[model samples]
Target: MTDLVIRNATVVTCDPAGTVIADGGVAVRDGRIEQVAASVELEAAAAGARRLVDGKGHILMPGLINTHCHAGDSLFRGLVEDLPLEPWLQTVWKAEGAILNPETCYLGSVLGFAELLLSGVTTVMDMFWYPEETVRAARTVGMRVSTGGIFFDPPGVTGDNLKGRIAAAERFFEMFSDAEDVFPAVLPHGAYTVAPENLKTAKQLAERHGALFSTHAAETRAEQADVTGRYGRSVIRHLDDLGLLDERTLLAHCVHLDDEEIQILARTGATAVHNPVSNLKLASGFARVPEMLAAGVRVTLGTDGAISGNDLDMWMALRLAATLHKAVTGKADAVSTAQALAMMTSAGAEALGAAGRIGSLEAGKLADMILIDVKRPHAVPMFDPVTHLVYSTARSDVRHVFLSGEQVVRDGALTRHAIGQTIEAVERLKPRIAASIA
Candidate 1:
């Protein structure tokens, strides 16, 4: 017998051919999709389902995947804005040192996950120090999280030394190796923070453990110059020489790649995660997404962190991604609605190494999906669901969210804990967070 069945919805199957089914339904058995067909067909097939959800007048699609983020950085939202990458890093690092701990990390992660889940993000790739705590928070809210111990040499931080951080990362990999909803990764802060030798070691560790290797790369001109001055080559070249460029690598930012660098990424099969709103907010230059896509580099989208991104809404990023490149290149077809949707959905799942299982709404994939209410004013007069999703849909339009066939968000609210409690927790920490930076 199936666990749940959702019927009478516009099912958008983000498949290889972009299939859409009107008045369709989905059957879920044991947390995986059992069938996707017309409502009448599923009514006959899914008769044994324990629960039935009426999805009438809604758009049911795959859950959005956030490819790169620092979930613990949500606590620092608006704490330090209007600054470029370097100065912003200095301020954030200080704030992290002063106020960051396991408790606070969990709180910030809960806050971030709550925000993301409300906005239709089911899977998130987070790079933070207290990964175990983050995982705990994710579990509390039913989020699929990819994370691991972070490697960086900033003073006043635990594992401030490379050796200590690597040791911690090894421990994390073993601890979370068999975790169900968690994907272990090795996250070095960046080329600018980590030495070449250490990056090579981290990459080797990730390879040995069969985990994803992620890091920030080439987000700013200043970063490029610094890496060039130190390594006598671009940051991408240095990483390539260290054997860090591979299919398992997920590079964040990548907002400043040249033609050669783009070609290198394509050749290595490494994924570049574009953070459009964050890039524009930080005044970081735009990534050559059109060039990268044409060159065969797999590009995905991220909101970065709540602070620089201002919010964890993928709809905002989706719209910006759909429109920004066109505005910059004067080409209306720079990124199509389909391409933008793919970046947020399938490309993100591919980057997370969960493509075969979760990105698309297919028969055999896990039942991770969202129901967007199209009966609203902004979404009215909908001609194309893809266009409406990419251009008009808002996070508030998310009516229900599911992960592993379980409803975690219903009627626009979290299922487990009260969001008001999360807000209160963060509000209580605000004074200390402010005092730390002050």
Candidate 2:
């Protein structure tokens, strides 16, 4: 018997051919998708399902993949604002240094993951301090997370220095070697905070253990100039020189790249995560997403952090990405609805090196998906499902969420934690967090 079956939904299968089923059904067994067909076809196939869901008036699609974020900073949302990357980082880092511990990190992650689940995000790639605590929080909430055991000089939470950081990552990999939901990576902060030698070491460790390596790059003009002054090259070129640019590398905020730098990213096969909302909120320049996609570069979507994005809402990122590029390039066809959807789904899966897994609703892939209520005021008069999904849908439309065949969200409420208690817990920490900064 199958674990769960969802039937009678508008299934937007983000497959290679972009198939959309009017009345589709998906069966899940052993945490993997068993079948995807019309409801009439799957009725008998999933006749013995342990759980059956009526997905009427819902848009079913793959769970949104958040390619990059600093999830532990959720508690610091709006704490320090209206500043660019440099000053913003300075203040946020201080707040992190003052009160960051395993417990606080867990609380912040729980807060962030809960928000993500409500917004239809199931998988996230987080680069932050105290990642062990973050891992624990994700597990508790049953969210899929690909995060690094991060390190920096004058380390933030995990260790003291680069050496200490590598040791901690090794231990983390060992501890979570068989983890089904958590994928461990080796993440250095960036070229600005970490030396070239440390970046190389981190990449090598990631390669040795077969994990992901990621960091921020070219988020601002000041960052580019600093890297050029220090190394006589841009950050991308410098990382390439250090042998850190590869298929495994995921760069966040490639917002200020020139033509040559964009070519370098394409040639290196590195993935760039476009954070349009965060970039705009921070007054960072626009990323050349249109050019990147045209050059055959794999581009994905990210929400950066709740502090920068004001919320971990992928719908904002998707809608802004789909619409903002048109205004920037003065062409209405700049980033298509299909392209924007791909960036969060199939393209995101490819970027995270999980193309065979959770980004699509294929038969063998993991059953990570969300059901959005489409019989709402904003989503009414639906012409194209993809267009409505990209342009009109809101995060509040998410009705149900599944991770590995298990229902983590049902009817806009979290199944793992009490919403009132979660909010109250964070409210209790408000005084201590504020006093630390004071």
Candidate 3:
């Protein structure tokens, strides 16, 4: 018998052709999509399905993919505010030093991943101090995560030296080498915080493991100036000079890139992840998203972290991504709705090198999808489902979510884990978190 069947809904395939079925659903067997067809076409399968979900009054689409985030930093939401990237990070690090440990990191990651999973983000590329804890939290919340050891020059949260950091990164690869849900990566904090040789070492580890190398790059003018002063080149150029730009590289926040840098990214096939909410909140300048997209740079989306964004809301990210550039560039269509949506879906999966497994609704792909309720007042009279998702849908509209054919979230609540305990735990630590910077 089929494992599960969901019928009677609007299916937004998010495929290259952008196929949408007006009244259709999907069949899942052995944790993979068996078929995606009209409700009428799925009747025979539904008859013998182990479980059937009637997705009436909903739009089913592929789950969102967050290409960049610090999930554990959710513990510091709204703690250090009204500062730019440089000073802001210093305060943030001070707080992290005081309160972050493996246990707390896991707690905070659970809090953050709960928010992401509840809002239809099935996969996330998160950077945090405790990558094992990050993976633990993702598993507890029943979501996919891409994370590994962190690389920082100074004694950060883990306080590991260069040799210790290398060992930790390699150990991470060994631990999760077979984990289907964990995508291993080596995350150096940024060019400003990590030495050039350390950055190269991190890249080497990633290359050796065939994992991703992610770091903050040119998120602000100060960062660009600092990197250029240190290396005599801008952030992207410095990375290229070190031979670190490639298809496996995930660069967060190319907000201050020049025209030549944009060309370099396109030529190297590195993905640039845009965190609009955090960039705006921290007063970082707008990313040249339109120029990058036009240059054929594979652009993706991220929430950054709740610490900077004040929340992990990919819908807000999606809406801002779809609309923000238009206002900045003085063009009504600077970024199209589909392009913005792709940044969180296909582009994200591509960035993680999991394009064939996730990202869109298709036969033989993992059953990672979400159902958005269109019964809301704002979602009514939807002309285009994609437009509605981009401009109208809210996180609260995500009523059901499936990861690998398992019902991780049902009726807007997590099924694998209860979040009330996590909330209470964070609330207890709120005072300590506030006092860290004080």
TM-score, one value per model: 0.98, 0.98, 0.99
Stretches off by above 4 angstroms in model 2 are: none
Residues 196-215, model 1: lDDT tens digits: 88888888889889999999
Candidate 3 worst ten-residue window by lDDT? 77-86
What Cα-based lDDT does every candidate model obtain? 0.90, 0.89, 0.94
Can you write out model 2's per-residue Cα lDDT over 1-438, one digit (the tens) per residue? 889899999999899889999999799999999999999988886679888999999999999999998887898888888899899888888888887888888889888988988899999999877788888888777788998668586656544776678878898898886788877788888898888888888899999999999999999999999989999999888988898888888999899888888898899999999999999999998999999999988999999999888899999999999999999999999998999999999998898889899888999999999999999989889878999999999999999999998899989988987767767888998987787677
Cα lDDT tens digits, model 3, 38-80, are: 9999999999999999999999999999999998999998888
Candidate 3: which stretches are off by over 4 Å? none
Better of 1 and 3 by TM-score: 3
> Where does candidate 1 have its weakest 10-residue lDDT segment?
151-160
On the 0 to 100 scale, the lDDT of residue 153 in model 2 is 69
lDDT of 3 at 143: 96
| Best candidate according to lDDT | 3
Error of 1 at 272 (Å): 0.5
